[model samples]
Target: MKFQTIFKTAALAGLALAGTSALAHVGPDGSAHHGFLTGFLHPITGLDHLAAMLAVGVWSAMTTRRLWLAPVSFALLLLAGALLAQAGVAFPAIEPMIAASLLVVGLLLAAQVKLPDAVGAVLVGMFALFHGAAHGQELGAGVTLAGMVLSTAVLHAAGIGLGLGLKRTSAWLPRLVGAMVALMGVNMGLGLLAG
Candidate 1:
């Protein structure tokens, strides 16, 4: 089958997954959720978090010289950001930054930009702070932070896998996914503006 066909299928599936949840930071009870399972699922369940995290991995794999550096920087800073938030440190414009991360990461992938490893790591790490801060803001009693970090790592790995596998299948396949991710970012930005 054509790569375009596969991209279409994958994009639809991602959107479907994203559409299942409205907010990234809340549970069904409209309260902050904690614990390992909930933390692990948080990144997967939310549209913003899911797209940004996955895109970071894909971009890292496809562009960075050091495959693991970007992801590791993201993970560690994410933990730091969350820890800071847990400590009552507040970051301004957390949501906007998160949305912008999607936009930037998606564009990087679509453009097939090759960034220096440290640069890429720094870029992703900046976004991870915002993401971590957001998660930290809602952290409650339990081991939720650990679960969220694990989940984020998993999502990143999946993206890296997709980047590696799809690149071998068709060079354009990953670009197509990147475009879709960019569109999701645009939609999210517009939503922020509208709301």
Candidate 2:
């Protein structure tokens, strides 16, 4: 069961990205790190990426069933997306969609919306693809893709841990965080549009 969980988590996270700006080992504009470090640093370097990825774990734990399914689904689909990017595939409005993902996921968490496990997982996975592709488009030989995936998994675990711990204290806090995340998404989307 533990192995399954780790595998599933890895599969989901492996697909995450740091957006175009954040996909670097050092700071986005800083000196480069190796492939794994670069991949690991990508998501954390970007607020949008961090918020969305963390929300996946929070939402997953909040679900009544299949706690790990959503993140895993995200990881696998993300891998496919990154591969597409590497192959020269392009997606439209990836940044806005990335923000929208935070909005949607956060709102869902805030609202305590429930779906069948598979359905929810699929929805999350769909968003992961967008994020992965956005970052993967800039993927260089500098960072290994595996590092990025592993970092994503770690983020998911952190999210899950925080969600589980917080839920035990005050459910409202998590919901509050969700609402903030949603608002941030809106702000980000609007900024994107304005620019």
Error of 2 at 106 (Å): 0.9
Give the range of the ten consecutive residues with the poorest summed lDDT in model 1.
22-31
Model 2: ten consecutive residues of lowest lDDT: 23-32
TM match of model 1 to true structure: 0.87
- C-alpha positional error of residue 101 in candidate 2 after TM-score superposition, expressed in Å: 0.3
Model 2 scores a C-alpha lDDT of 0.72
Best by TM-score: 1
Best by lDDT: 1
lDDT of 2 by residue, 1-195 (tens): 498657744543332222233322221222223477777787777777788888888878886487788988887777777777667776777877788897899898788788899999889898999888766765544355676777888898898888788768776767766776676677776666676
- 147: Cα error in model 1, Å: 0.8
How many residue-pair clashes does candidate 1 contain? 0
lDDT of 1 by residue, 1-195 (tens): 899787786765576345224356541242267789988887777788888888888888888777888888898898898888877787887877877887788889989999889999999999999888888877653488889888889988988888777667878767867777776777766666776
Positional deviation of 150 in candidate 2, in angstroms? Answer: 0.4
| Candidate 1 lDDT | 0.78
